[model samples]
Target: EAGVTQFPSHSVIEKGQTVTLRCDPISGHDNLYWYRRVMGKEIKFLLHFVKESKQDESGMPNNRFLAERTGGTYSTLKVQPAELEDSGVYFCASSIRTSGRAGSYEQYFGPGTRLTVT
Candidate 1:
């Protein structure tokens, strides 16, 4: 089985620019998540998607960010008018669906996309 994969490995952009990051989760995984680490902060959850529907998105920072999982095959995170605070490593993770229980759903993460906003 293949692991989660993120496109563009790295990106550099000026402030107010728009950037889109893509992630392809492992085949057959139904639960996808978007996470990020900005500067000194710990890796934080951005959103969660179950198949093609958004399951949770409380961690999203502001209206400038948008996440989508069309057809539930891959996911994309877009930052419009990117700001300096958005510079960081964006991570993608996926897991199989499981009942609500501890340790039942193990997540596999991708290498991450590094975004640098100037």
Candidate 2:
């Protein structure tokens, strides 16, 4: 059963360390979204990628964080100088389409990659 897969089920890093998280979406899915929950905060959207292009990146928290979907395939998220506040579960989701759903589509999420910063 192929859905979405995230690497490094859990990671612990010291402050200022760089960490990279990866995501593999379902085959043929054209839309992908990244979201996360940090420090007991509500799940926040990070960005959306349609194929190899970033369709919406308004949710990116800061410049220290970078996201990319190369070759319109798997994606990678890198946080440079990871801060203590960067510890949280990062989720990846994908679908044929997200917005303007005719009620027949739903976003499928991965188990998530938990990052611990200290």
Best by TM-score: 1
| Model 2 residue 15 distance off true place after TM-score fit, in angstroms | 0.7
Estimate the TM-score of every prediction.
Answer: 0.95, 0.91
Q: After best superposition, candidate 1 residue 9: deviation in angstroms? A: 0.2
Prediction 2 global C-alpha lDDT: 0.90
Backbone clash count for every predicted candidate, in the order shown: 0, 0
50 in model 2: Cα distance from truth in Å?
0.1
Flag regions of model 1 displaced more than 4 Å.
Answer: 99-104
Q: Write the per-residue lDDT of candidate 2 for residues 6-36, one digit (tens) a residue.
A: 9988999999999999999998888888999
Winning model by lDDT: 1
Candidate 1, 30-57: lDDT as tens digits: 9999999989699999999999999999
Over all chains combined, what TM-score does candidate 2 have? Answer: 0.91
Which parts of model 2 are misplaced by more than 4 Å? 97-105
Q: Model 1, poorest ten-residue lDDT window?
A: 96-105
Q: Report lDDT (Cα) of residue 51, candidate 2.
A: 93
